[model samples]
Target: DVRECLARAGLLLEGAPVLYLSGYKGGQVNPAKGDFVFNCSAIYELMPTDVRLCQPAIFSGKVLSALGSIIAGIGRPMTDAMGTCGKAGQSVPSSGGGNMFLVIDENDEITIGGV
Candidate 1:
């Protein structure tokens, strides 16, 4: 179902990725509050295909649900995709996480541009 969704959206890749980058984040955090290190991130994942094919507003929302189903089917805890937080020109220690190694073809919902 996920593959079908991506293919319909014209995002199914036919070759290996040209690049995959991450491990860096920069976003504003409040010192008065928890100063969460989220809402922003720097990730560049490029595949060997036409980048212009991404459908910004395709109908049907089955892609995300399908991906979630895959994660649930794994029956294993996911690792946290952690990062840093900064506020008042000072970096603060924080804690949070996300699942990794999810297998759902090209699920865009899980790849939103945010930390």
Candidate 2:
């Protein structure tokens, strides 16, 4: 079912990825302006093809939310993100996490924070 969804979005690779990751480990956010900076990682497997693509990508919370909504509308299950927060020499555990989706369509574009 997940593969089908990816296929509809033009994200299904010719071969199955050896690995797939979703969610962030740590990040910062500005509640006043609803802005955030996060460190996220996703590793995909391009087995048999022998080609690997890696790059840094940034996406706004709005775009991420939209994608999550789209996935939910299609009945795909997503895992909740988890991380720990530290501030003022204190460490705190956090439970909130964001839904993640991989968009493979070349036409799928997301705008990050103001340019």
Candidate 3:
């Protein structure tokens, strides 16, 4: 699991801090162009017990598809239904999915889909 990997890598500290578990209902991606946009929602967990809401933000970056491949190399891959997706001139059922864990040292830098 990615969590275990993070722990082994010395990324998961004793406090555990805040962890964001995110899911997106719909999105668009262009593999050739290395671009993506998602309508995402997330759960914010503060260590042992406290749970809080997080604001959604746009995720834009280069090589998103490549990012997925990199994540799979280190952790487990997973897919689940978020809802529906539409792109170009076609509408179809689509889901947003990814690996189990990614550890970021800076909390302020974290961005999720929807609050």
Candidate 4:
């Protein structure tokens, strides 16, 4: 499995199919001819921990965007987070797999938290 391959390479990060801000020019570009790609030396990692109050929303960039929506959206350029100055889009270990917590307010708004 890719996870095992990564683990053997001393990479402990989780989550497969990590989003590629740039499909071709990007460093982690995967060729269509290959069945899988190993990223033992992936420079970017997922953010440490993130809590989403709303469902079906992705909070990767500055703004919150809907997930699996047909709306056309624009994204910012990816950066390295572990450089001399930390930048966004540079991967870090995800908090974990699954929702961390959920709360229902009196106003009926639902809140979700996850790493």
lDDT of 3 by residue, 9-110 (tens): 655465765455467556557767766666656555543434566665554444443354332223566676476556587767667565556544432223
In candidate 4, position 47 carries an lDDT of: 25
Off by over 4 Å in 3: 1-9, 14-19, 43-52, 64-98, 102-115
Candidate 4 regions with alpha-carbon error over 4 angstroms: 13-115
Over the full model, what C-alpha lDDT does candidate 3 score relative to the true structure?
0.53
In candidate 4, position 51 carries an lDDT of 17
The weakest ten consecutive residues by lDDT in model 2 span 105-114
lDDT of 1 by residue, 1-115 (tens): 3344344545546774322223444444333542223232233344544332222221122433543545222224554645555557766566654443233444543344321
Candidates sorted on lDDT, descending: 3, 2, 1, 4
Alpha carbon deviation, residue 60, candidate 3 (Å): 2.6
**Lowest summed lDDT window (length 10), candidate 3:** 106-115
Collision count for each candidate, in order: 1, 2, 1, 6
TM-score of every model versus the real structure: 0.26, 0.41, 0.45, 0.15
Candidate 4 similarity to native, TM-score = 0.15
Q: On residues 2-91, what C-alpha lDDT tens digit does candidate 4 reach at each position?
A: 233334443334443222111212122123432222222122222223212222221221111112221222233333333231138555
Preferred candidate (lDDT higher): 1 or 2: 2
Which segments of candidate 1 are over 4 A away from where they belong?
1-12, 15-21, 29-45, 48-93, 101-115
For model 3 the TM-score comes to 0.45
